[model samples]
Target: MPAGIRLFLGYAIAILVLIGLSLRFVIDQAISMPVSPLGVVVMALLAYTIFTTTLVLQRKEAARGLAIGLASLTIPGVPLAWFTFAAGPLGIVLAGLTALLAVALLRGLTGQRTREWLSEP
Candidate 1:
């Protein structure tokens, strides 16, 4: 698929999934999140969305290292830390894992094979 189309579709899918899951959790569990917790979720989603779309646009060489570094520092790291030490919700940890997977897929799409292909014909 074209990069633009893929990116748009990825965004659409991610947003829909996030919204549906969040609503289901809230409605089914009668869960009420504090503003800070909500803010963290929103920030993570926004960061992952930007990073995924950027990777999809063939800017991987520039972004790959940075994205990896960010993921290592934030995604699993912070969520796991919170879940273990600070009593963060399991839902937050799961959301972070999803974001990490999206970024990993985006990175994989720009592998050495594609780089070699671009370097050739």
Candidate 2:
């Protein structure tokens, strides 16, 4: 699988499982099957934003797409914040930090196909 796909799935699945564990262990509640519908939506949006920016970068709108990608990194934090309540704002901060790392990781994935993608043509 592509790194982007792998990375996305890794984060998605980890977050889901974490959601379960957080509810069970941290929040002292039973695991809800779907957890949160909004979580699914947030993941979808984050995935869309990540891949589309990559698509745009490959299509020659490199700078713009990269900026969008960087800006969008914080998207995942929203769902992480929403679903995991015990962590408070710290969870949000860490998620945003994770997202920043994800931006570079994603850039590595997207840029792997073309070193020139982020450079002036």
Model 1 vs truth, CA RMSD: 8.7
TM value for model 2? 0.33
Rate residue 63 of model 2 by lDDT: 39
Best model per TM-score? 1
Candidate 2 lDDT by residue in tens digits, 22-86? 44443232244455565565556556555654554454445344444544555676567646764
**Per-residue CA lDDT of candidate 1, range 15-83, in tens?**
657765675554444345444555566557656756655563554454444444433433455455555
> In candidate 1, how many Å is residue 52 off?
3.5
Task: Spell out the clash pairs found in candidate 1.
Answer: none
Clash pairs, candidate 2, are none
lDDT of 2: 0.52
